[model samples]
Target: MSINQSTIKKLYGLSAGRCNICKRVLIEEDVQIGEMAHVIAKNPGGPRGADNLANDNRYENLILLCSIDHTIVDSKPNDYPVSRLHQIKNDHEAYVFNRLSNNRGYFEDLLALNTLFKYIPILELRGMAMELPSRISNRFEAKDMFDNFIRGNPHLYPFKDRQLDRKWCSVISNMEILDCWILGSINGLNLITISDMYNSDPIPQPCYNIYVNDERGYMALNKRYLSPEQIDYVSTEVHRIVQDFIYSHTDLVHYIRNNFNEIEW
Candidate 1:
């Protein structure tokens, strides 16, 4: 028998209108690009077919995939075996549910949370922050790093949980401020200095001579510089912001770990 409308709805809805494999958007404003592929073929000679399995068109026996993935899986049934397809379906649905539901304790949630790190350079930033004056060769490069972080906002996994959402927002906000500060300094609208004190002495003490600029103060500096004490204060604040960003990422990872429970295979 052909798959019923209710089964089709469940397949598409549970997959969240995206391909189960590549996570590509399957449904758009004027197009439907999703294909429901059978895990066990209806005919015994078809890809992944079985001789005794009955009612092959049920939801449990199907997966939603993009046109490309559907073609790939059907063309290579040995690689995309029945067990593997079912696992993919379960994981994708769990990821969708974790994003949408408040309950939030799926094994897939940890994977989803870690996936965000791939889109941005948080680890690189943390390393640079630790090395401080020695790591930053050009001030504009630091600005570029922050720009990358801001651009990754659109690609991050959408967390529907209130606490997770709040932490993500705070991370984005702090990154924006740092980006603005670096850009302002580069343009000579504000001043930010990096230096190594005691360079003349045998032991060089690397230091970041940062200058604080409020939103309005971006134009106020106007190529002027700050005193040594003022620089030290601003540098401390900037370092704190970077620390907070790192802490936020850590907090998100811990939150996912605390709620994680293994899915039955």
Candidate 2:
């Protein structure tokens, strides 16, 4: 069976643009010279033939290789057996995956730092006078709430029904992010002056103008900045939170629907 483009692309990314056998960079000047090699030849009576070809055209059975190494491995299957090739492919993919994860974390940390820079200035510029310390503490609380939400930590909400309370409180906590943004905007802070942390995804028109949102509307705002996989993860989580809120407070949901415009959050 022929390998589809999707499988080939996944193998290309997993190999991290390098040859699995030689561990050499496979692309130069945007031209990909690497080849996809089958760990098990499809020929009849081969050691790793038909029975072992379940994932033959998939990432699991594919290895990236330079032109020379591809010819060498295919010619010397006895030397580079199936087990050895699998080991090499897995090890390389693991290393690349870890490196990418670490880099992503590093990038997120930088974004957090930039957000802090914007946040601190807004608090300071507000000039809360005697309540400055308390206001700053509130800002810290807001940031902590957001941090816990993003990291999937259960927030400490003081109520008998912890699950529902957390779901409700999470919505409130997210509101604070917007509260700070509005405060900054009102105080003549250039919209451009602040990092577009909240605006990473397109802000819903209502969230900007009217400030009304249901769980899905909120999801559109909070999860807009996430990657497709991350969006799926956060979507699942937010859906659960919304479900919990609805199940616990069915009457309130109806009330909100009827009086949402008049109900000042």
lDDT of 1 by residue, 1-265 (tens): 7889999999989998899999999978878989998898878888898898744888999999998999999999999999999999999999998776644433233444554445444445555444332223232243354355447644444554557667666666755555554554444332443221212233222323333334532223221345566556556756765677667657754654455443111
In model 1, where do residues sit more than 4 Å from their true spots? 102-265
> Model 2, residue 70: displacement in angstroms?
1.7
Candidate 2 residue pairs in clash (backbone atoms < 3 Å): none
Against the unseen true structure, what C-alpha lDDT does each candidate score?
Answer: 0.63, 0.53
lDDT of 2 by residue, 13-46 (tens): 8888899877899889988899888778666465
Q: In model 1, where is the ten-residue run with the lowest total lDDT?
A: 194-203
